[model samples]
Target: MSYKLIPPGKRRNRHYWLRGTIAGERVEVSTGCETRQAAQAWAADYVARLEGQRVPGIGEVVAFERAAELYKAAHPHLSKSDIRLVGAVAKYFRNKGKACHEVVHADLVAAADELKPGRAASTKNRKVIGPAAAVLHYAANNQWCTYQRIEKFWVSRKSNREPARDEDLAVLIANVEAPPRRKKFGRKADYNVAFKRLLLLMLYELGLRIGHLLTVRWDDVDLRAARLKVRIPKSDEIASLELSPVIVSELANLTSATGVNRPALGRGVDRRGRLFPWTTNRGVHAWLKPLTDRLGIKYTPHMSRHKLATDAQVLPDKKAAELGVWKDPRSLHRYQHVRPEAIPGRSAATLLALPAPDKRKAS
Candidate 1:
């Protein structure tokens, strides 16, 4: 065996350390065993596992920490939030001295309870359960553990956020288009106003998420054809949408105005640069809040998207899903908030028209 098993000492800490090369891959990790005999056995098993010589049912023990490391190595493109979640799960399991194969449903539930405590079920599912399941599943795929399904906590279906009303949106658009009182900033203020107005229009018309809208460049737009090419961030797919005439007109007006006649100094529609001046959603929301507050309407940037989804309920499921860039047509159900009057065959007039019977007999 080319693998070297070093005994516990000043350098090796309490656990036995395995360091050497196997199959041209450098191996350096703790065996998580105290006795020299156990360490030697672990080192041989690990080398055999690495070389694909060992069967799945063999006495091959893999620590949760090691399994997590392997999972991370396999998937290098995980998002920052996903990385944090995986790290948190690995840390908890490492502290517990848990093996990847030994983890059960109870262990996962306990981990969630201990790690997230009083957090919501959805939060725990995202932060703990989901990440831990991913690591364990990856380990199972590699024969380091048996596959175990981890179920997520059931979350409520009720949503607190109401979709923006047509009247409210109209009021917002009118207010943004009206002249800015602050003449000191002059063109800068006008530019900001114009940008907000256009942003609202696109959010309502295109049914795009706020993140997708912020990243759209001028090259993605075709005002002449009244078309827009939006990059869906989640799926990493480009979706082409037919632009509304209102949006095309606004974009044309902004692009045509230049020099002293322009709203701002910089190019209105740079082919390379993003369409909106703001890089982050926080900046857009901060600018929008005061306007919403002044208008006496409770609104958010995402509310525009909800409004689009609600309005699209009249269309077929497939058509509605396409409008929202949803991968599943069923997802439209979650977003659509049908008004009382809009519910098919359930209008107040229809109920009123029904004959009221048996009232005299009861009296």
Candidate 2:
């Protein structure tokens, strides 16, 4: 219930009014008295409004499943994963919507409890509850749902976990290089030599997302300059990354050796592509996870971005501010003396760092 406080009248009388309904029974309470007395009286009347019911709007609850359907209908063109995730969240909320009471502190806590059973934090969290809360917020906005969407209502509290150490990165790299994935002969072959690893490396080396990588063309590479152009996803930022001769050589060799080239990578094309003709992000993650496990590394696609930011900040030649925090000038001071840990002694480490790519030339 909400109240309207009125000032004292000429005769010193004031009006206090309450609004909102109980069990779909719209109720209004008014006290031609002072604000304090009216507030107190309204609280008493609110309890009176719900005297006999366990929940005022128990049957009016909108299931998460239903909410998800509405959300999908609202955004039919979302990415495949995003659409799938919306469905997942809807199912999750549908299960949680079984409660008999309006959302309370306990209901929120209970919701958190249910979400905590999942072992993968990212899977059960940011990707799941975060998006689910977004849908609920949308529902609440449209008046299709009652509960006020809250961050804590749909997910558990998150803690700050530090990223992987370089030593761990080294171990993971080593493991992938030496271990066997599927055996061609009696011995297992190293997993990442396939196209997925190259794709991953592009993300690491150029900070390119999979969508952005799919748009890459061969002519964008300036092998002699040891630089490449990557038009970033979702932003106007076209990054010009400097690379090493060895890195360039690796890509050059792959292009030359592939049995057939994709039309996207053909002459006169304007984007880079998966070094392997056909692949997906799922395949890359599938291959990378085992390698990471064997090496006891907790690496993910994001680690490459972290490695770049962390390493760039530590570079003796790089202005600490230029490390990765592009928007704020104040952060340069924080990393003033810090330098990125040296990468594993790979030939690519010797490459030059490239500036953000110039995209104006394309237009």
Among all candidates shown, the one with the greatest lDDT: 1
Model 1 worst lDDT window (10 residues) = 339-348
What is the Cα-based lDDT of residue 332 in candidate 1?
Answer: 62
Give a tens-digit lDDT track for model 2, residues 1-363.
Answer: 433444456644466555555545666655555667667676566655564342323244555565566667777666688887776655555666642124344543455457556445545555656566766665566665565635443323332333335454444433344344465567754433534435545655553455556555565667667766766533456667666555665565452223333233234232354344435667556667766665555777655545554565334433433333233334323333324332333233322233322222111
lDDT for model 2: 0.51
- Listed in order, each prediction's TM-score against the native is 0.72, 0.46
- Which ranges of candidate 2 are over 4 A from the true structure? 1-65, 92-112, 115-123, 144-149, 153-204, 207-250, 256-273, 281-302, 312-363
Model 1 reaches what TM-score against the true structure?
0.72
The CA lDDT of each predicted structure is: 0.72, 0.51
RMSD to the native, candidate 1? 11.6
Top-TM-score candidate index: 1
